[model samples]
Target: MARYDAIVVGAGFGGMGAAIQLDRLGLSDYVILEREADLGGTWHVNRYPGLAVDIASVTYSYSFEPNPYWSRLFAPGEELRRYAQHVAERYGLRRRMRFGTAVEQARWDADRRHWVVTTGSGELTARFLITATGFLSQPYTPPFPGIDGFTGRIVHTTAWPDDLDLTGQRVGVIGTGATAVQLVPELADVAAELTVFQRTPIWVVPKVDTPIPAAVQRLFAALPVTQRAARLANTAVLEAIMVAGVLEFTRAKVLNRGAGLLAKAHLRTSVRDPETRRALTPGYDFGCKRPTFSNRYFRVFNSAHVRLETGSIAEVTAGGIALADGSEVALDTLVLATGFDLWQANFPAITVRGRDGVDLGAWWRASRFQAYEGITVPRFPNFLSLNSPYSYSGLSYFTTVEAQMKHMGRLLGELARRGAATFEVTERANAEFLDRVTERLGTSVFYGGDCGSARSYYFDPHGEAALLRPTSTLNAHREAVRFPLDDYVYGGVPA
Candidate 1:
């Protein structure tokens, strides 16, 4: 069996970040396991049309390695993928990484004080395990009736084929999440007729996306500080929005009301049909669900060839989609904009057995998914999960990865300092952290608003919110840095 200091699963931003941290700590014996043939994780997998980042391009990159060559304010997926590859190649992570290796299961060996990971190729052991598999790694397609009967081409945004073409073909997209918002607009321009199936409406804000001028790019390249300033400026605006829209409900109510009004005005201007505008508008309060930004989304409905179906999908016929009203829409292609299983406990599709053979999935099923500072969980010795459970960053996902990677580095450092072979968060400490996290989460608009009834993944089946961290990004960063090592239990002989 191959052995290493640490084993990181998933080659996304989180996994790459973890690898970089390990390298910086001089622990060069770590390998990143990527399921796909290449790095960039989601960025490499998702290659749909009109796919661009919702966040500003300037702030989307790592704070340590800023990219000054971003073409637009909202960068497309390919650029981000290239950036990920660049980061890996620059840090010499590509050679050490094991691509096309999918981890099947990981079991903790109590006697050896290490993890035995089973993959497609063979078994590998590591003193420490890091799961950076990402939240949206698993794409979920709802089992609609007769969905298999559809002879037409079926596509999901997560696994978009490169050679697949929809030009001059009748296309139907089901679900109106973030991907649909960007895709429908692109499809409208090419497809002979585009039909959008919506079960619930999401809050749409204007995405003020613009190309970064060549001179500005040149300036950013000449003076790196200027790009940093731009990133900070964008960060400040996004932080303020998150604070107003979630952290402070009283303030959020006012701010979100104003934002909603602006969205309404945009909708009114874009969609002239009163019925279409009404159908697009969400009934729940803003911030109840994941809010999306798109300047062209609302305008897509204005196309004469585009049609939005608000009724429930009765079933999928061989010809096309059948509505509950006995109406059928013929289509040549079917695109399931259906999102991933965001809150599913069985993520990564890996069976992780901790001490006493405790299954991670069963544990989460029995109790609410809780983690110490969203990184380590009780009973999971020498394991850290990045961007999982409460570790999610509201303003930026990069913040979550940064903080967790830093914290994981600290844990590894402490292990080396004490010569301990194993470290796990104490049950008492995990419980105490949960007490505080749940209390703080209650104060957010997710609980105060009508989010419980909305089609949001933020709230779990038990009415508990576990998707995002309740505190501000700054607070999360500070907490990750200042977290006391005494909160965990370190064991085993000296390394």
Candidate 2:
């Protein structure tokens, strides 16, 4: 059995960031267990065509480790993967990582005051357990009737096979989310005929994608301050948009409408057919689901070779898909762009047994998934769930990571100061935090707007918005960093 001071599950951006933080704290006894053969998490796994970052490259990167060599404003998957590799190597995290290891279960040992984590290879005990498994770690595929009968090549965006070519083949892509928006345009030029099945229309604004000029890259490389300025500028713009789209401030509705008009104009300019444009427009609010950015997605609908199907899919036939109206579209290859199962499969998949055989998954289900400051739960001692419920404050996840690190860092510092073996947030503190967040969310666009009807994954099974934090990025950071330490019970087991 292997033992350490800490064990980070998953080697994605969150996991790598946590490992780097621990290393900075002079705590060398830690190991990163990654399920894949390599790092980069989503960037490494999803290799579908036209894979790229929707957010600006500058803002998407970590502030602690900035990359000035991004080839474009919005980076491709390969570039992001390279950035992850660079961060790992620069911070000396590659040596501490255990590749090709999947964590199966984690049980808290009350007497020992440690976590016994079971993996595919063996078990390891750690004083602290940090889950950086990520929200989109698991992929979801809808089960259509007669799907097994389909003889054609079928693939999900998350599990795209390498060397699988669709050139000149009749293809059909299901789901119109962010992934499908990027993919349809790329497939338009390759497939002989393309069919897009849309369950709900997504609002897509123009992506101002441009190559990073050589002079700009050189300037960024020469002076690091310029790169930092660019990152800040990009983050400010994203935050402004978030305030308009998600928050319900005095002028928020007006700003949201203005943004919607811009998206509508872009759609109109891209597609000539009024009927096609109407079919493509989203009925819900702009920020109901994650708004996407693309320059080629809308134009793909205007192409003579592409067709959009909005009717209900009655069933999937061996030859093709059959609609409820008895219409069938033949296809040689099918791709599912359906997103992920975060709350259902991803979070609950790991068997976490806390004190007295209490299951964390069952508790979350019964209480409608929550955490204290989106990091600590009541019964889970010396554990942190990074980027979990109500943790994400801004558009970019880097802010969330930084905020969580601040909170966790303070806790660790206090533990050392008191010479404590373990700590856990009190139930009162958790409930108070949840109450404050819920009160703020009640007035937010996600709660009062048409978001509930949009079927976005942001809302849980209980129709409560458990994904995004209701406050500004700065506010969330301040709360996490400076909140009262008395809200937690430190040292020894609970009575």
Candidate 3:
């Protein structure tokens, strides 16, 4: 078995960031295990039409290796993939990475203090393991009646066939998430007729996208300090605005209503048809599910070729989709915008052990996977989950990621310097931290029973909110970044 000091899982932004930091800190003995054949994670897999980042392109890059070559306000998937590959090569991370080798299960070698890592090829051992396998890695397709028997091409946005063409065919697109938002408009132009099956409506915003000029890109690259300062300023301003929108501490119900009203006005202004505009508009509050934007999505309905069905897809027939209203739609192609099992899809790929033969999944399952401060969990010693559950902020994912990772790095560094074998968060510390998180989330509009759409993944099974962090990114950042060295229980994995 091959031995290493650490093992990093997944090759997405989080994992790449982790590996880059580890190597820069002189921990290159670590290996990054990628399930796919290449470095890009979601970016590589998702190649559907008109796909682009909803966030601004300028600040979406890594703070360490800032890229100034983004061609648009919203960078497309391919450019991001190239950027990932470029960053990996630049950092010399590809040398230590093990592509196409997935860690099936990792067994903790308790007697010797190391992880016996099992992959598709063989087994290896490592002193430490990092679960950078991000919040959304796995694509989940819901099982529908006669789905396999459908006499049509079936495709998932996360796993699109690059060669597959939809020209002049009748298409059935299901689920109105980000993928459907972008693809529906593109498909409208090509398909003879398109039917969209939406289980619930999501808030749609206009994506104000524009291509960045080559001159601007060159100028930003030329002045590193200017780029950094602009990024910091942009980050701060957006975060402040978002925090105010979420918190009920000072804002009135009228104010919250006003924000929602403003979003509605934008929708009406872009989408000319009243019926078409209302169909695309969400009945729920903003940020119930992550709001998506595409200038084309709303206007796509104006095309006589497209039809949006807000009714639930009762089942899939051989011909097409069976709506809840006993209506049948015909199609030659089917696209599922049903998103990945975001929070818990990677549970099967992981094998984590804690004290007394305690299984991490089982412990987490018992608690329904809620973590303290959305960072630490009881029993999982020295295990750090990046962008973990409930810690995810829709407003600024990158900022939260960098701040929390920097904090985890500090604790890991202290443990390494002290020769500590293992470290686990104490139960009391976690309980107190979680109380604050849950309390803050309680008052947010996401949990306010007013907005009516079917219970979303943003809410837990028992009707508790799950998707967002507490109001303030600054508060969450400070809580995560300013960890006291004395609070962590330290012992080496080999102790």
Candidate 4:
């Protein structure tokens, strides 16, 4: 058994981020357990034809360690991989990473006030367990009747096999979510014919993407402060957009419709055929399910060879997909661009036994997965779930993660320094914390109060989601960065 001060699960941005923050605080006794061999989490896995980030490179990176080497305004998969590797090397994170070690379970031990963590290898004990298993880590594979019997190759966008070639073959992609928005364009040029099955139309913003000039890269590399300043300036602008989308934007769904007038112009501008352009147009508000920004996605439908079929998928046939409306589409290949099963797989394949041997998953399921500020759970001591709800939706995950991590770091450091054995939120404190989150979520557009007529995850699991921080970016920064520790009453075993 190897003893350690703390153990971080998953090597994604959140896990690596937590480890990096731990390093900055002069804490060395920790290890990062990664399920994969490489560092990049989602970027490492999803290598489909047209994969890139929706958030611009300006705000997608870390504030403390800015990468001066993004090839494009919106980075592709390759550039993102390089950036992650660069961060790992620069921060000395490579030596600390334990690859191919999947965490199976974690149990809280009341006697020692530590976590007994189980991985693929063996049991390891640590004072704390930080799970960075991202929201999109687990892919949701819907049951398709004849999926396995498909004569042609079948692949999910998340696990695209590099060997299979899409050239000249007829392809049918299921699900018109973020992944399909990118894939349709890339496959349109190669495949003889392509058809996209749209469960629902998603709002698409015109991505004003351009290659980064060499001179600009040199300028940022030479003057780091200027780059930081630019990031700050851009962050400030996006913050306003985040707030306006959540609350007081409009009285009815017409606000989003009127707001999409410019998007219509861009759609009409990129797509030539009036029918194709109208088919691509969305009747929903922006920011619903991570607003998609694309320049080529809209134009892909104008090629005359591609078609967007807005029908539900009934099942997969031996030859191809059968639509819910009794239509059969033939294809040589199928790609699942279906969105991830985030927030649903919050606890799976891992038995998290919290205080008194109570399972966190059962607790969350029974209580509807509510958390205290989306950070702390009521009974889980010295445990933190990274990038929890309400902390998301800003689009600038870098800023949001840093803010939350900073607050967690402060809590951890205070505990370590004071020799505190265990720390968990009290029942009253957890209730009050939820009050703030719910209040914040209510003010936002997600409560179905305004902005548009489209239903979004901002409402609930019943389509009435109650998530998102109500405060502005600056206010969120202040609260997350400089949160008061007094609200949390300290409790622990004797030193």
TM-score of 1: 0.98
What are the models' TM-scores? 0.98, 0.97, 0.93, 0.93
lDDT winner among the candidates?
2
For model 1, the superposed segments whose C-alpha errors exceed 4 Å read none
lDDT agreement of model 1 with the native: 0.86
| Whole-model lDDT values for every prediction | 0.86, 0.88, 0.73, 0.75
How well is each residue in 219-298 modelled by candidate 2, as lDDT tens digits?
99899899999998998888888865677633478878887899999999999999999999988888878889999999
Q: What are the runs in model 2 whose C-alpha is more than 4 Å off?
A: 249-251, 493-495
Worst lDDT window (10 residues) for model 3?
244-253
Q: What number of backbone clashes does candidate 4 have, counting pairs of residues 3 or more apart or in separate chains?
A: 7
lDDT of 4 at 62: 80
Q: Which lDDT value does model 1 have at 103?
A: 95
Q: What is the lDDT of residue 81 in candidate 4?
A: 82
- Give candidate 4's error at residue 151 in angstroms: 1.8
How should the candidates be ordered by lDDT, best one leading?
2, 1, 4, 3
Each candidate structure's count of clashing pairs: 0, 0, 7, 7
